[model samples]
Target: MGILERLSRLIRANLNDLIRRAEDPEKIIEQALEDMRAALREARMEVAEAMAELRKLEREQQSYAEQAAAWERKAAEALKAEREDLAREALKRKQQAQALAEGFAQQVAQQQALVNQLTTQLKALESKIQESEARKALLIARKKGVEAAETVRRFESKVDAHSAVEAFDEMERRIEAMEDKHKALAELDRNDIEKELERLDANRQVEEDLNRLKRELGLA
Candidate 1:
């Protein structure tokens, strides 16, 4: 693209948007600002060169004008001396000098116009550079804010996950406690059944022994 178009794009760029899209926003923003500064410096140099050309043209014009005026005075002196031929020659020289002066004046005017245009462009570029510099801090801050928000989100997610884990652990502990209680009740029930069995077996043995004693005493 043309220089002006490039400059305009650079000047109009949205730094915040750039920062948001950049992978490394600080580095990118700094580089962009530096590029703008470099462009502005180059534009300033161009403006200086244009102004120098304009000054040279102006001096040339002035010199030619002075020569023309001196020739005109010489032509008048010739006329005052009543020398027609010399007067005519002097007039001819004066005409040539006047033509040269007019041409130089035109050139100077064109150079002046170029200088003015370059100066305006240079000023605009400088202003753009300044504006970019001013916004850099704000753009960096915005990037930092985004990063902070992301960090907070991650922290909250971790906290939520930890809470879920703790809840799950509590549920497991409660289930284990209930299982232990059920196991204790089952053990108590088994012990009661075993005691009843033992009592019945002992009574059966005692009856048998009583029968044996009766038989021996002849009371079958």
Candidate 2:
């Protein structure tokens, strides 16, 4: 079988089973994509080469056709010259050129068929490569999301394992202790300034009373 045939077989293979059997999913997917791209490139090259071959065959067929026509003209000229032997030899050459032209025409037709087939196969391979690339993008995105989710879950588990609740409780205890300290500082029942104001009021009242008594005794 041809390379394209083998590549088509590989492209048609069951991906799910391959993925399941692969030791590394990422590597396998990458390799498969690369292989598909390589095959597509090779197939395109083959199509180009086949088309070139077909064109060469067509050119050969045209050459033989022109040669056959030239020989027929020579045979006619020989007959006009009344040379039967020369005309017969020219006719024989004409027939050989005709046969060669016919053979070339057949080969050109077959080559064209092969070229068309290869071109169609190349287009199909390109479509398949595009599909594989799209799938690879989606697969990579999904894997990244899964890995991100797993990382988040692992971080949460680690935090939980480290007892964040106990750390919060410790912080609460420290804040409560600080509040108690402020409460103790504010616990004085009476103020020294208030007691001093009370004593000054009492002395003012006694002085006023003594002055009134002196005025009443009429010492002035």
- Clash count (model 2, backbone only): 0
The models' CA-based lDDT, in order, is 0.82, 0.83
Predicted candidate 2 versus true structure: per-residue lDDT over 81-115, tens digit per residue: 99888988988888888899999999999999888
Candidate 1 has its poorest 10 consecutive residues by lDDT at 8-17
Once fitted onto the true fold, the runs of candidate 2 whose alpha carbons sit more than 4 angstroms away are 8-24, 163-220
**C-alpha RMSD (angstroms) for model 2:** 5.2
lDDT (Cα) of model 2: 0.83
Q: Give the Å shift of residue 159 in candidate 2.
A: 2.9
> Which of the numbered candidates is closest to the native, going by highest lDDT?
2
